[model samples]
Target: AQTVTQSQPEMSVQEAETVTLSCTYDTSESDYYLFWYKQPPSRQMILVIRQEAYKQQNATENRFSVNFQKAAKSFSLKISDSQLGDAAMYFCAYRDTYSGGGADGLTFGKGTHLIIQP
Candidate 1:
């Protein structure tokens, strides 16, 4: 079984600035995928980025990137050039590829509320 944790309950950043959201996971399985999802006021879970455990390089998308510390089991999200639209609830999710349950094997953390200040 895997569990994800977000230590910070909330984070605030100014527009055009950069902010990093911390995430950590505990898992006995070696093959898995890490993901950062953003849920806005509309309640849509948007995929921000994803990182595969076997990959040595961290994943990046546009202004979003991840600092993946495999051995330490840490995956943090960095949002650069933040915008007002970036404000949302961010969740860290884990999917065990070895589980064979597909999307059903996903485990998520309690989200962190991100607030963008103008």
Candidate 2:
């Protein structure tokens, strides 16, 4: 089994600035994937970034990036040039690939609410 944790319950950032959200996970399984998903008021889960346990390099998408410390089992998301559109509830998720190709649903963190101010 895997568990995700988001220590910060809420985060605020000024428009055009940068913000980093903290996340950590616990899993005895060596083959797994870590992800950051954003859910806005619209109630859709959007994939922000994903890191594979086997990959030494972190994953990044546009202004979104992750600091992945495999040894520490930490995966943090960094948002640059934050915009109002970025305001959403961010969740950290984990899935074990070893289990029949991850047929089970992902385990998600409680989430961190992000507010962007102009």
Candidate 3:
């Protein structure tokens, strides 16, 4: 069984600054996938970024990027130039490649509540 862990239960960052959320996972399978999702107050699960185990390069999007350490099973999300809209609950998720498929629900961490300071 694979599990995702988010050490920090809550995080705060100043607007226009940057914050990095830490995430770690345990998995026996060499080929898997990691994802970071954002759930705002609206309660919608949005895909922030995803990384494939087989890919050596980390995944990045706009102001969001991942620091993936395959050997250590660590995948962190870095948000640059954060904005007030960025405030939300960030969840780290894991999916086994060999598992069912796309229809299978993702295994998610508790989540990190991001607070934005004015």
Model 3 C-alpha lDDT per residue in residues 21-112, reported as the tens digit of each score: 99999999999889999999899999999999999999999999999999999999999999999999999999888656554568999999
The true-versus-predicted C-alpha distance at residue 76 of model 2, in Å, is 0.1
TM-score, one value per model: 0.95, 0.95, 0.95
- Candidate 3: residue 40 Cα off by (Å): 0.6
Off by over 4 Å in 3: 98-103
Better of 2 and 3 by lDDT: 3
Cα lDDT of all candidates, in order?
0.94, 0.93, 0.95
- Minimal lDDT window, size 10, model 1: 97-106
Ranking by lDDT: 3, 1, 2
Query: What TM-score does candidate 1 reach?
Result: 0.95
Instruction: Show model 2 residue runs off by greater than 4 Å.
Output: none
lDDT of 1 by residue, 1-118 (tens): 7889999999999999999999999999887899999999899999999999999999999999999999999999999999999999999999877545445556899999999999
Where does candidate 3 have its weakest 10-residue lDDT segment?
A: 96-105
At residue 38, candidate 2 shows an lDDT of: 98
Write model 2 residue lDDT over 2-103, tens digit each, in one string: 788999999999999999999999999888889999999999999988888999998989999999998899999999999999999999999887566546
